[model samples]
Target: RAYRMTETRGIIHRRVQSIIFVLIATACFLAVSVLLVFAPLLGRLAEAHLEWIKPYMGTITIWRYIIASTVIVIGLFSVHIWLPAGKRRFVSIIPGIVFTLVAWLVGS
Candidate 1:
């Protein structure tokens, strides 16, 4: 029963996740990746205001959390809705890539 549910979800989710996953993943990655990409720029700012910004530094560092949360919530909800019973789930890169490309094109 569990296995069946997961397969049903895969069938349904593959399509939807393909449509929106990439855009959201890109958005999420961009949010976190930018900071790492521009670490030198942040270093400059940090030097100028270490004492004040120190407290919120951790929070400010992870804008990508929003993207991650959004994706997880949407993906889980989608699975719950679309999946049948008796199915379990697994993860693989091909599905991820397909989903990303679809999401990139369809989401825009």
Candidate 2:
């Protein structure tokens, strides 16, 4: 009984750690995406418009992009993390690469 309890505790601990790790990683990716999206938009706005537009656009456009990107990353990685261990690597990496390529193509 004691051994079983200890094993369960270890499993619980591992799960908690993994969840925290995922959250941090998701946050980081979201931040990076937000910065990436924000800089170009701000630049365009600056070039075509005035400085006054900065504050107005920052909240509406920048925040929305940050939230949306975060959600997308979370959605994709959730599927990756939830799948069985054997299939997870394939599931996570393949879709990621495909999506990245499509994004680059469309952007270019």
Q: Highest lDDT among the candidates is held by which one?
A: 2
Task: Report the lDDT tens digits of candidate 1 across residue range 11-88.
Answer: 666776665755655665665455555654785589587877777666765654455445554554445443334423
Q: Using alpha carbons, what is the TM-score of model 2?
A: 0.37
Cα displacement (angstroms), candidate 1, residue 60, comes to 6.1
Tens digits of lDDT, candidate 2, 1-108: 311222333566768767877787677766766666666676676857686666566576666666766666665565455422333454546666468647955995
Task: Please give each candidate's TM-score.
Answer: 0.35, 0.37
Each prediction's RMSD to truth: 9.6, 10.3
What's model 1's overall lDDT?
A: 0.55
